[model samples]
Target: MATVCISGALVDKLRACAEAGFDGVEVFEPDLVSAPESPEEIRALAARLGLTLDLYQPMRDVEGVDDAEFARVLRRAEAKFRLMRRLGVDVVLCCSNVATATIDDDEVSARQLRALGDLAAEHGIRIAFEALAWGRYIDDYRRAWRVVELAAHPAVGVCLDSFHILSRGHDPAGIREIPGERIFFVQLADAPRMELDVLSWSRHHRLFPGEGSFDLVGFVGHVLHAGYAGPLSLEVFNDTFRQTDPARTAAQARRSLRHLEDAVARADPSLTGLEMLPDSAAPSGFDFVEIIAEDTSTIEHLLARAGFTSRGRHRTKPVTLWSAGRARVVLNEQHARGRTPYLAAIGFEVDDASAMSRRVAALRTPRAYRRTYDAEEELEAAVAPGGTEVFWAQAADEGEPAWVSEFEHGGPRIASPVTGIDHVSLTEPWQVIDESALFYTATFGLRTVSATDVPGPQGLVQSRVLAGPDEVVRLPLNVAPPILAERGGPAALSAHVAFSCADVRALARAAHLRGLDILPIPANYYEDLAARVDLDDDVLAELRELNLVYDRTDAGEYLHVYTATIGNVFFEFVERRGDYAGFGAGNAPVRLNAQSASSAARESGGFGRVRA
Candidate 1:
């Protein structure tokens, strides 16, 4: 829900929200209307505190009333609409009448709602008819939708509440059928199911999102599935939450958001690949690109085969290539770059060479080596190798080889696509996921963004990674190196995959259309998934077809996936779109099956598809 409003009574609620990293907050009417607080004062405070006034809510009883009162409420709605336009807010909360004389007359309510919605739309705002669980006429979303359908005003929409929806234990099968445009508001609140009357629970004693028993996540997923992309407010009737320190409350609110985020990700079964994306927090591209190549000559041969020409010669490290587009590749000749390379690093663009060096050093780990510029160039190098470790930084400002005389004198240049090392894969020997997580956290200040662990015949190794700023560069660290070879030789041919994707869905579609044959585990994956992440079939299937997987652990969020290609040297097409912090873990089993089948084909010299 985009327009989630917190009642103004929770004005202190802003404190709770800020602590929790909320992007905006909605202003409930009671806190503003009931109080002596002026709209000017409320607006000013929100601006001063960096909160968007998501909405002015609770314009109740506009529908199912006689002409006189209906006209009066219409005027009141106009005034609020004025305030909203001035405040740059676009939504209004209109709850169904509870205390008024309106009986369950859908026809009458529908007529009145249409008239009022037209009035509100003039002021550039929409009305959200909330089906109060205890309302005299409208209570359930299905009922509200029927009324809205007849009302049929573009600005007239529904407010889906987690409390109202889940409190009754309604199934989502019917709700998912609603179109996206009709969903104007979403309210999520949690509470222990008290023995008291439903009305009393709605009025007081509502718990925060994660603190309650109701499946708010699932409910939100349902609403999302219905195509309602609007404001989502946390409207809680909990007295305890209000009484606590506002910041703590807000932090809890943020935690609730993260909690719900993970819940939605895990709850959606359509997932396939788990990839941590790059972030803008760090100025560079990638900390390092892992290249696991055994025979040093093979490392050399592989580079030659890939059209990667050396930048004169390798220094500090062996068989490294300094390329165009501000990129560099380190061939760890220890193991012929596994069908999946180890430590394929991306070079980061840096403005302050010294400051970046200090920042990298601050992240403690196997101390990185600082490479001094040789006789040819001025840029120095530093290498940090743990998953989150800041393995290397090539100063684009003063240290690149292009600035040196050789390239300048020869009028030379590198190839197109201007190489920028996008990602790297690291392996941890410890079988424990937490231990691997600790490696990234300690070395690179990397936190576990997302993860997953599935029960397979071969078991699973939970994965984690430090998603650097905006999650633009992902350095993934694996827990329990998949047992590729028993003798600690390179982790196996099915070892790992490094991918690049212009569009992840296109990659999946490419595979599928080419008869790569994706697996179908369950049809229900979509039933509840869209409700969680708000992704469409194209994106979801692509993620699934890619075999991305994810999971939730007490330690943190995790998700990932391996591809369908052969054991070695395949790619994972990744595009860091948003806060998806993990790879697609939901697609693991599908990936395993396809991979095993592909491997079999190579041995038998014949490839076949999974029969429907």
Candidate 2:
């Protein structure tokens, strides 16, 4: 935590950090200077909250200067040391001077650092020297380490920061060369790959570990391999995080630490001696997806047309379960606010549901409880950052299935066509994308793939996919374009679930027979597909008849079709042959255009019912 940092009062920041389960905090100097509390009072507050004052940071522009300037910096350092004495902190961070540096020689800088270390030793404190990426002369960690080595003082050592090392394209493999005992502290931060000045990028664009493209797992692994066992502290500086609520930001920071620990542990099993929480059980597959709507008629009709049958009704609530093949959809109408339908919950089939609950609790994520009657199967759930509930349940076995007892199956069991969920699309505003990505990766142990930009009717939408290591479950997250009220565009594209089948043509034929309103595709798409890929004439004709869009890569071919938007949600059916691993991103623009047109037609007329 950066002090005088993040959005909140000083006391509130400390309290939020403690409540969010951080073991200790690095007190930023600016925050402390502005606070009304004396050093003694703040120390007492931290003590009362069972928090450790780990570091007092940062004493800057104290090295690589003229003699007179060095003398002035020495006096300033003494004053801060006295303050740290009162605060019961033994260590202070000294960042490389980015300004006020006249000397360029490493020997001069080391001599100055040694003089400061001598002062720190007299005060019973140590200095952790750090290298900022934008420092005047010493911009690299290796350079900072060289000065620390030349200083040759007991109280002087190097502080390793991930951002400074990684943002400069410095290889972390060199970290292992530094003696473990000389590495005094470690700071971690992640950022997306951006083409900008280092100072501006570091100040505003940093994100939490899994939210960004940095390889923090490998970074931390190198640090651990070097035998530095200090607290893994987070020092993020982002415009969005600073403006958000302090408590929420603190919780997210803590989760990132836990995630980093788990990832490092998995990367290096040889580091078994290091303390870390056990990784969450890997997800087997999706169990069920629940939708909440005031009137389930439209959703039910769409599901029926997609070849799903009403398999069961919740024994205790006003919910119905629709099944197709092994896939299940729960229509939860018991507590709906309006006619607009939205995804309410996602259930995962795991090896141990209870273990997942415990893992989530350890990360300080809040649990959500739903009212249940006697003899009902209780599923453990955690609330995601986007207000979606994630339920965990064990995979069903031959002996007994939990769903059989939870729902009353009275309708005929129709032979289902769809196999399972290929992917689930989640939409969020651009600013919330990083937060949502961190939530899923930390809570569920999912790994993120590279982000791709899809051209939409409104604008270019950024999309990233998160999936398990084995690719059993996939979640494609989209950052929606800004709403264009003048152009009459919706705020976001509606969320949808895509079901996979072995033969999409057969499923489309069944859907057509059931009178489903297939989203109309323009003939231009077929001509484009024909020029792009060589497809059999019969398959092309069948796809044209079913209004399906096509995309083929070197790996495999993708065929998919979308349903008309019903309320705030929609559905898609997809078929993948060979090794097609994409979500037909090439066809996003056409789908968005068609959906927008349909929405306009529906609004021009009254919101009349559309039957399947």
Candidate 3:
């Protein structure tokens, strides 16, 4: 097991951090740093709260300059060390000097590092030498570690950062070999892989752990195996999390932890899953279920032919349904908004939606309000995309109970009607076609469902699907061609269709060899993409060349897949990159062809493959 840290700001933001399974806090420095209380008082608060001080960060620019600057830096280190001593804070995070360094020569820089280490040793503190992304002397850990080893002071250690580690596209094996005792701390943060400068991103937009595109679990495993038993703390400097409520921020923290823990369990059996956290991996959780049609008449005729009966109006959007006991189908119109659901969001049953809503609101995270049918009349349960809904009549409305009662009654099968869709992967691009795919796979545990080549005006793109949480959701991994160059792109693929794959690249290769009109994504996307992805240049190039999309999750698994269309069946071809298991939600279509011949055939009562 690895040590976990609860950031000090998260204490007030998510009072539940410790209760949620965190072992320590980074102290965030500023919490105690600028507080009115004495340093010893903060230590008392930590002891009373059962929280350990994971780290005190950012002794900026300590190395550099002549005798005069050196003296001032030493005095500063001394003051910080005294604060550490008073609070029993054992670890000090000393990032390599980034800005305003007076030294330029290599020899002088080395001398400065040795001096810092010596000062830490005198103050009885262990210094975690981390190279800021823009450090003047030490930038890469491998390069900086040379000075750390040279300092020869046992107090100097390393702080392995997923961002810094991945930003440079370096392998993690070095971390795996470092003595745990010598590795003073591990910093955890994830971000959507971007092409932004390191400093701007770090101070402005780092994401919470498991929320971005980094391979979190594998990163963690590498650290754990390194024998470094330091606290794993989140150092996200996200604008979004800060804008949201503090309580919900805490819940986000908890969920982020659970998502990562569960991802770890799925990716590697050795890692433990969180017990207290609610997960999308919960048994029977439905990702999504689909009933497709080119037009409304087609759907009505199809369901009518199947002898299915229609349920009443949907509480939200334009979703109609046909049902048989324990077996139900939902009909979504083609005209629905956005890429896919201009029609409906999602609905679920809970014993107490209001209570759950209150609990969620108590956390103060953003939430959507919804109304539902109650025991006597209309009742309201605040609803959004995920759980947090209560419907007393959901059992009867859906033709069965929402949850299978294991209370002496839970048995053989509690019908959810049709098993739910794993997840719906809707692939659209803000120019970056892969961003959507990365978001779902990395933040959630969705795996690559499929990847298939499609003809486009611009060329071919082999989009893939990823599925995870092992639920009933269908992610329709879709893809469109690049805006420039090539022939017209292929059209008439469905708005979305979830995919699953045993092998993602092979699937892409299969589609490519199959002559299934493939689209070409730029080769440079891989090189640029490599900055965020942990894979080697070759692997990144191959995935991009195949037009396949992939994202790393907190578990260090690469969820990838290919897109496919089997006649009017419209299915996704999936491949799991590494251990990833998410449906590509980023791949969706602007238009779908339900078989051109079939639409005409249906009008004439000719033979047409019927869909229900």
What are the Cα lDDT values of the candidates? Answer: 0.55, 0.84, 0.52
What local lDDT does model 3 show for residue 209? 62
Against the hidden true structure, what lDDT does model 1 obtain?
0.55
RMSD of each: 18.2, 2.8, 13.3
| lDDT for 499 (candidate 2) | 93
Candidate 3 deviant stretches above 4 angstroms: 1-16, 33-36, 102-111, 262-308, 311-321, 324-445, 448-472, 476-612
- Runs of candidate 1 with Cα error greater than 4 angstroms are 1-12, 34-41, 269-612
Q: Give per-residue CA lDDT, model 3, range 1-612, as digits (tens).
A: 011222334335224455544566666566665567777776776667677776777677776577888788889888988888887877788877777676765466667767777777777778888867777767777766666766666777778887788766677677766777877787777776678888777766666665566888788877877776556677777655555445444556654655565556667666443232222321233322345343444444433332335554354545565543333445656454333221133333333444434434333234444433353234333332222222222224344554222112211332121222324434343222333343344333355546666553334545655544443443444554544213222243334333343454554564454344333333454565577767877876677666655666665444443233222333333444454444332332211222333334445876322111
State which candidate, 2 or 3, has the greater TM-score.
2
User: Where's the lowest-lDDT run of ten residues in candidate 3?
Assistant: 403-412
Cα error, residue 207 of model 2, in Å, equals 2.3
Which candidate achieves the best lDDT against the true structure?
2
Ranking by lDDT: 2, 1, 3
lDDT for residue 81 in candidate 3, whole number 0-100 = 87
Q: Which runs in model 2 stand beyond 4 Å of their true positions?
A: 269-273, 398-400, 484-491, 536-538, 606-612
